[model samples]
Target chain A: MTDTIAIGTADRKDAKTGTVAANRALAGPRVNGKAVVMTLYLVFLMLPIYWLVNMSLKTNTEITSGLTLWPRQITFDNYIRIFTDQSWYSGYINSLTYVVINTVLSISFALPAAYAFSRYRFLGDKHLFFWLLTNRMAPPAVFALPFFNLYSAIGLFDTPWAVALAHCLFNIPLAVWILEGFMSGVPREIDETAAIDGYSFPRFFVKIFMPLIASGIGVAAFFCFMFSWVELLLARTLTTVNAKPIAATMTRTISASGMDWGMLAAAGVLTIVPGALVIWFVRNYIAKGFALGRV
Target chain B: MTKTLNNKAWFLVLPVFAIVAFSAVLPLMTVVNYSVQDTFGNNQFFWNGIGWFQELLDPSKELGGRFFEALWRTLLFSAIILAIEIPLGILVALSMPREGWTVALCLVLMALPLLIPWNVVGTIWQVFARGDIGLLGWVVNHLGIDYNYTGDALDAWATIIVMDVWHWTSLVALLCYAGLKSIPDAYYQAARIDGASRWAVFRTIQLPKMRRVLLIAVLLRFMDSFMIYTEPFVLTGGGPGNATTFLSIDLVKLALGQFDLGKAAALSLVYNLIILAICWVFYTVMTNVDADRERVEA
Candidate 1:
C-alpha cells in the first residue's frame, strides 16, 4: 500500500526542476496574492510564539502591569533563574535523555521490521501493518492510567526507559510505517546484486542498505524525537521527579508566589529551543516526514 | 514489484512486536480488566460485568450525560478545526513560493508550532490570549470586543479552536505542500495548453494529486483534535465550567483526578474503540485508494 506513495515521491524528486520552472511562470501573475497569503499565515503562526518570547524577556512586574509588543524593561532574570535552578535544568536533561532513548529504540526496532515489510510478504503482513497503525491512533488518555499502573507494577515507572518504552506504542509503528515507504522505493534488484556478490544478509543490510536509507532513518528518528519530546501525558504520568520531562516541568510553573509569568514564559521559550534545533536539522525532510513518506 | 513470500521475515518483526505489545497490549488488557470489574479502595475488586458500560451508554445517567456531552463537544471541535484547517492549509500550500530561500523559511516557521510541547502551546496561547498581558487579547478588547477566555464559555471555545488552528494548520499545509511538489510539470503545462482556469487547474490537477495527502491530513487532524487534552488543559484547565473539557481531559479528570477506576476504564475503552473504528475506516479508504491507483497505473 505504501509502495505506490513512495514511488510517487521518488518520481517527484526527479521531476522537481521542471516543476519549479513551470511554477515560476504560472505563479507570475499571482505573486502579490501569494505573498499576502503567506505573510498573513506566517504572521498568524508567529504571533503567539512572539508573545511568549516577548514575555520571557520582561520582568514579572512589567509583564503583568501592561501589554507590550516588545519588552519595555528587558530582563534576563527569568532565563538566568532557569539556568541556575537544578530542577529546571534537570528537566531539559531528562527530556532529552528519554527522547534520545526513544528515538534510538524506535528506529532500531523499526529498521528490521520495515525492511521485512518492504522486502517480503509473509503471513498476516497486511493485518500486522494495519494493527500497527491502530496503535498510532490509540488515545494516550486511554492508556494513561493503565500505563501508570503497568509501569509502576513492573518497577519501570519514573525512569527514562519507562517513557521510552511507553512512547514505543506509537513511535515504533510510525518509524516502521515511514521506513517501509522509503525502503520500498529502493528496488529489489539491489538485494539480488548484493546476494550475487556473496554478501550475507546482515552484512549487506548494515554496509549497503543502511546507507541507502540513511535519510529515511533520519526522518524516522526525527519523528520519534518530535513525538516523544512533545508528548506529556504518559511521560508525566509515568515519571514523578527523576524522569520528569521539561514539558511536564513547565506545566508545574505555578508557585507559592502565584503565577510566575516571567519564569513560565522563559521555560516555554527554552522548550521551543530544542524543538527548533531539531527542526532545523530536519527541515528538508519535515514535509515528507509529515506525510509519513506517503508524498 | 512482488515481494517474495518468506516466513523468516517474522524474526525481523519480533523486536517491534515484543516492544509494542509490552507497551500497548498489557495496558490495554488492564483497561479491559478494569472496565469489566468494580473496584474499591486498597485494590479490592469485584466483577461488574457491563454495569459501567450500561451506565455509560445511557444518557439519562450522570456519567452517561457527561460522557455524551464531552463526546459531542470533541466531535464538534474536530469537525470545526478540520473544516477551517484543510481549506486554509491547501491555500497556504498553493500560495507557497515555488523555489527559493523563502520556501525553506516558510516551511521552518510553519512547522514551529507543531514541535512545541502541547502544554507549552496551551501556555503560549494562554499568555497570548490573556486580556491583561496577551497581545491578541488586549488588541481584541481595545477593538471594542469583550474577549475573555477564562470567563466566557464561548470565548473559551473560540480560543481553543483558534489555538488548535494555529498549532496544526501547518501540518496540513506541509503535507499538501509535499503533495503539490510531487505533481510533475507536465500536468501544469498540459493544463496551460488546455487553457484551464486556476480553479479548474486546481480541481482537475492539484486536487486529484493531493487526494492522498489530504486524506492523511484529515485523518491526523481528526484523531489529534478528538484526543486533545494538554493544550486545553493548560489554557483553561477544561475551563469555566467544563466548556473545553474534551474526552481526554474528562477521562484524566475521572481516572486520575477522581480515581473512579471502573468508570474511567469503561470510558477509556469506549473512547479507544471510537478512535479505532474511525481509523479503520480511513485505513480502508487509504488502501483502496492505493489499490485503485495501482490498477490505473498498470
Candidate 2:
C-alpha cells in the first residue's frame, strides 16, 4: 500500500533535478540488472508494435508467404489508401472529431463536479460522486446492447455525435475522478484565499483554482483522448463502415478473399502514431495523470 | 457567488445528468422494462415478471451457472490480475530511472502497448500466435511446448490472462512509478539516519505512503478486469470452448447472439448490480484505508 502511494505521489515531483553523478552512480551493475530487466520488458512490449509497422510497409504477398524482421521494400500504398479512400480517412476524422469533443465536454462538466466534491460539503454529494463512477464500473458490453437499441430508437444512431455521446459514459467518470485528484492536490486554503479577496466563487474557480489544476486537467484530457482514440467495442457498435474508427476499419481485412495483412498492418502502424505523438507531447502529464487515474 | 451557498454548481452537474440520463439512465430503464417482460416479433411484449430472473438463478439451466462458479472465477481473475500487476508494477516502477531523458523515452514506449485498441491487441496476438506463421507458435513448437491456445481450454485461459497482463500491467507500473517518485528526500534521510535496511525502509515508509494510490489502483483494475470484453472477444472468441468465457462474453452471447433482450437485460441488470456491488466494496475499502492513513498521520 505504501509502495503504491509512494509511486503515485512521487510522480508529480519527478522532474529530475539530481546531478549526473548521483544518477549515474545508481546505474551500476546491480541497477543494470533492473535496467536489463526493464529493457527485456521494453523489448517484450515493442515487438508486436514493430511487427505491425513492419507488416504495414509490406505487400500482401510478402506478409502471407514470408516472415522478416524488416520489410524488404518499404511502400506507402497502405497509407495512401487510408488518406485517399473514404472508409480509411473517414474513421480518422470521425474518431478525432469526437475524441476532441468528448475531451473538452468531459472537462467542462467534470471540473465543477470534481471541485464541488473536492472542496465542499453539500446535499448528496458523496452519493453523486459515487453515481458518477457507476458509469465507469459497468461493463461496456452491459451497456453496448442497450446503447445500440436506445440510440437507434432516438434517431441518434450511426452518427459521430452518437459515438461522442456514448464515449461520455466512460470518459466523464474518468475526467471527474482525475480532476478530483488535482482539486484535492490544491489545498482548500487557495479557494478561501480567493474568497477573502472578494472574488466570487465562480470567478475564483476560473481564475485561481483552475490554473492550479491546469496540469491536472491536461493529464485528464490526455487520458480521455488516449482511451477514446483506442476504444473499439463502443466504436464498433456506434458506427458502421461510414463512421467506423480506424481500429474498427482494420477488421475488414479478415474477409473471405484472404487476409490483407500488409494493408491492415499499415493501418495498425498509422493507428499507433497518433497515440505515440500525444504521449510524446505530454509524457510528464501522462506520467502524473496515470498515478491519479489508476494508482 | 457567495460562500453561503452557490447553487450554480447545479448547472454544471445538470449536463452530466442529462447526458447520462439520455445515454445511460434511459437505456437502463429500457433494460429494466425488458427484463421483467418478454418480447415477440414486431416488438410485441408480455409481462414475464421475475420468471426470467428465477430461471437464470435456477441451477438446471446451462446458462445458469452454479452460484460461486462464475462469481468465484471472476473474483479469482481479479485477484490474479491485482496480485501479479501490483507487485510487478512496483518492481518496474522501482527499477525505472529516477529522472532523465531516458525516463521520457521509457514512459512513452511503455505506454505504446496500452494505447492500441483492445481488439487490435487481440488481432496482433492472433496473428502472432499462429503455429504455421506466428512467431510465438513456431517458437513454442520448436521448444516442444505443444502450445495450442485455440484448441485447449486451460491454454486459452492462460493465454488470455497473459495477454491481459501484457496489455494492462503498464498501467499499474506507471502509476506506481509516479507514486514512488513523490517521496520527499526527508523521509529517506531519516531512514538513513536510523540505519534502516532497504526492505524495512520500503515496508515502513514507502508502503504506508502509497496506500491511497494503491486503493485507487486496485479498484480501477478490478473494474477494468471485470468489465473486459473486446480483447478476449477478438483473441479467443471465448473459445476453444467456454474456458475463457467471462460474464461480458456470456452477456453478449445472450443479448446479441440470441437477441433475447428480456433475459439478456435481466442478466445485464444483474451484471450491473454485481459490478456496482464490487466497486462499492472497493470504494469503501479505499475510503476506509484513506481514513486509516489520516488517523495514523494525525
Candidate 3:
C-alpha cells in the first residue's frame, strides 16, 4: 500500500514542519465513555503482569495456600537467589550475549542492504528482497532440527553465536525493511551534496546519513533486540550447557518434585526488566516509527 | 521513485545474503532433501521419491488426516483471533488519550505484555488461570462456570484464545493508534465544517486512514497465529488430547517428539509452502496498492 508509502513521506514532512496546530487539535481532556473503555483495558493488561510480580514476592508455601490478590508476606528470597546463584544469573548473561550479537549483526548487515534496496537496482533485486522476507515467515520449529544439525556440523553448536546467527535469518529481513523506509525518506540530494563536498561513501554514511536515520536505526535495533531476547525455542535448541538462555533455564524448575512456582515467577519478572528498560529508552522512536508505517 | 541501475549494490548486500544463506538456505535444503526420501535410522536414506509427500497429502491416510486437522484448527484460530482483535484494537486505539503523561503510561503498559518472553507469558497465564491458586480460575468456579482448562477441551481452547488475545491485542492497538495519529487534524476540521456526525467522520476519514496499518496488523496476526507454538505449548502441552494442537505445535511434535525425520520433513515443507503462498498474496496486494497510489500521485 500506498498507505504505507504515503505515511513515509508524511512522516518526514511532519517532522520538518512540527505542526503545532495538529497536536493541539488532537490533545484535550476526555471524561466520557472512551476514558472508561481505556481504563478497563489498562486493568486487563496490567492484572496479569501484576499477578506475576505478586507471586514472585510470596513463598512457595504461601503461593500454594490459596488465591490472594496480593502477597501477605513480601519476601526478597527469589530476587536474592537470582542474584547470588551462578546458574540463575548466568542465564541472563547468556541471553544478553546472543541478543546483543544478533541485534548488532542484523542491523549492521541490514544497513548496507537496506541502503542498496532504497537507492539502487541490482540483478534479482526485487526477488532477492522478497526472498529475504520469505525467510522471516519460516517457522522456527520447522528449522529447529536442521539448524541443530547444520550448526553442529560447522562446530558452532552450543555457542551464543549460533543462536545469534540463526536469529539473523528473521531479524535481517525485518531490519532491512524498517531501515529502508527511513533511508528512503532521506533526500538523495543529501548524498550528492556530501559527495560533492569531498566526503567518501563510508564517511558520508557514518557522519551524515546515519544520523539522519538514527531514530530509524533505533527502531530497527529495538525490534531485533526484542525478537531475539524473547525467543525461546531456537535459542533453547541451539545452545545446551555453556550458552543456555534464561528462558530455557526457567523451565528447569519443572523437576521431579514439581514446578518451582515462586522461583519461576521471579525469573519471569526478571526477564521483563531488560525489555522494559529498552522500551523506556526507545519510547519516542516507536511512536515515530509507527507514524512512518515502518514497523 | 525510479531506482538507479547499479549492479555494484550487490556488493553492499553480500553480507546479508551470506549470513541468511548459511542459516536459512542450507537448513531449508536439508528439509527439502528429507521430504522426498524414506529413512529408517542408521543415517541411511532410501530413494522413495514423493512417497512421504503422498502420505501427507492423502486424507484417508493417518498422516494426511492429522495434517489437515491441524491446518484447519490453525486457520480457524487465526480467523477468530483476527475477528476479535482487529475491531477491539481499533476501539481501544480510538479511546486512547492523545496527550499528556497518559500517553507515555499507556504506551509502556500496553507494550509490557509484548516484551515478556513468550514462554513466561504462558507461565504467567498458566499460573493465572489455575483452578487452585489463580484469581481467574477461583472466581470462575465460584461463579458456577465449572471451568477447568486442564480437564475440558472447550475450556482449554478458550484459555489459549483468551491468553493470545491478552498477549497480542496490544500490538494491533498500537499499530492502529499509530495510524490514527498520522491522520492530520485538518481532516477532522473539514469533516466538522461539513457537519459530519461522529460515525460518519469515523467511517469516512478514520477508517480509510487506518487501512494500511490494519493490513499490517492482519498479516502479522495471521502469520503469528498460524505458527503459534510457545504459549499454547507451555499452557496445555498440545492437549487435553490434541484439542489445541495448531500447525507449529504439530510440526514440532512430528519433528522433535517423534523424530520421524522424513515425514516431519515432508510436513514442514507443506507447512512452509502454505505460509509462503499466503504471505506472497499479502505482499503482492500491498505492493499493488502502493503502485496504484504512486500512479495517482504522478
Best by TM-score: 1
Q: What is the C-alpha RMSD of each candidate to the true structure, in Å?
A: 5.8, 5.9, 6.3
**Chain B TM-score against the true chain B, candidate 3:** 0.98
Q: Please provide the root mean square deviation of candidate 3 (C-alpha atoms, Å).
A: 6.3
- Tens digit of lDDT per residue, candidate 3, span A1-295? 4433443454454446685343223332223667999989999988888888999999999999888888999998989998999998999999999999999999999999999999999999989998998888889999999999999999999999999999998999989988998898888999999999999999999999999999899989999999899889899999999999999999988882776888999999999999999988877666656544342
lDDT: the better of candidates 2 and 3: 3
* DockQ each: 0.47, 0.38, 0.42
User: How does residue B218 of candidate 1 score in lDDT?
Assistant: 96
lDDT of 3 by residue, B28-125 (tens): 99999988888788899898788999999999999999999999999999999999999999999998886888898888888878888899999989
> For every model shown, what is its TM-score relative to the native structure?
0.95, 0.91, 0.94
In angstroms, how far off is B161's CA in candidate 1? 0.6
Which of candidates 1 and 3 is the stronger one according to DockQ? 1
**Candidate 3 chain A worst ten-residue window by lDDT:** A22-31
* Candidate 2 local lDDT, A1-295, one digit each (tens): 4544543333322325433343332223435677887898888887767777777788877777766768888888888987998877887787788788888888888888787666666666668778878887778887888888877887878777778888889898889888887787677777778888999978988888888888988898888888788777887887775567778878888883877777777777777788888888888777678877433
Candidate 3 regions with alpha-carbon error over 4 angstroms: A1-31, A290-295
| Superior candidate under DockQ, 1 versus 2 | 1
lDDT of 1 by residue, A192-272 (tens): 999999999999999999999888889899889889988999899999999889888876768546888998999999999
What is residue A6's positional error in candidate 3, in angstroms?
28
lDDT of the structure predicted as candidate 1: 0.90
